[model samples]
Target: MANYKPDLSCQNKFISVNFSEQIQLGTFEYALYYIVENKLDLSGSYAWYDKTGAVTYPPSGMLKIILLGYAHGLISSRRIARLTKQVFTL
Candidate 1:
């Protein structure tokens, strides 16, 4: 057996920077988000229906994130959710 100890020095350190500021205005992700939000109308996709209570997220935004994940070959729902969170946080 070999002696092993974990190094914790860098583990607890955190750096804060705005990822939005770092992204160039003309980047593909930015352009895609913009087009999905403004240009592509998804109003017909939503149901003005009876009793689902309330919906928090818009269909267009969710579609954009899902499409982004699909573009990167993240086909599974779980992977897409994880990637969406990671992408949004950055």
Candidate 2:
């Protein structure tokens, strides 16, 4: 099995957010999250990693971020980085 960074969706901070509640049932974000988490086979992403190294971010998480960026018409790496850092509710 591939080692992954912990899912921080439920982690409490100064501003608490229930991520599940943020993504509504019928939205595109919800659909994308569901398909990537439940349907996609991402084992291929782990093939290049050596388990001896540090735990990696989940491929599903990365894919979701990238796809969401693309969906918002953000193709530039800088814009995507900004999107990840700046955008909370999309």
Q: Rate the local accuracy (lDDT) of all candidates.
A: 0.62, 0.81
For candidate 2, the per-residue lDDT at 25 reads 91
Per-structure clash totals for the candidates = 0, 0
- Return the top candidate by lDDT: 2
- Highest TM-score: which candidate? 2
Give the number of colliding residue pairs in candidate 2.
0
Report the lDDT of model 2 for residue 10.
Answer: 65
User: Could you list the CA RMSD of all candidates, in the order they appear?
Assistant: 14.1, 2.7
lDDT of candidate 1 over 33-89, digit per residue (tens): 778868986667555332355434556656877887888788999989987678545
- In candidate 2, which residue pairs get closer than 3 Å at backbone N, Cα or C atoms, i.e. clash? none
Over 23-47, each residue of candidate 2 has an lDDT whose tens digit, in order, gives 9899999999999988988878867
Model 1 scores a TM of: 0.59
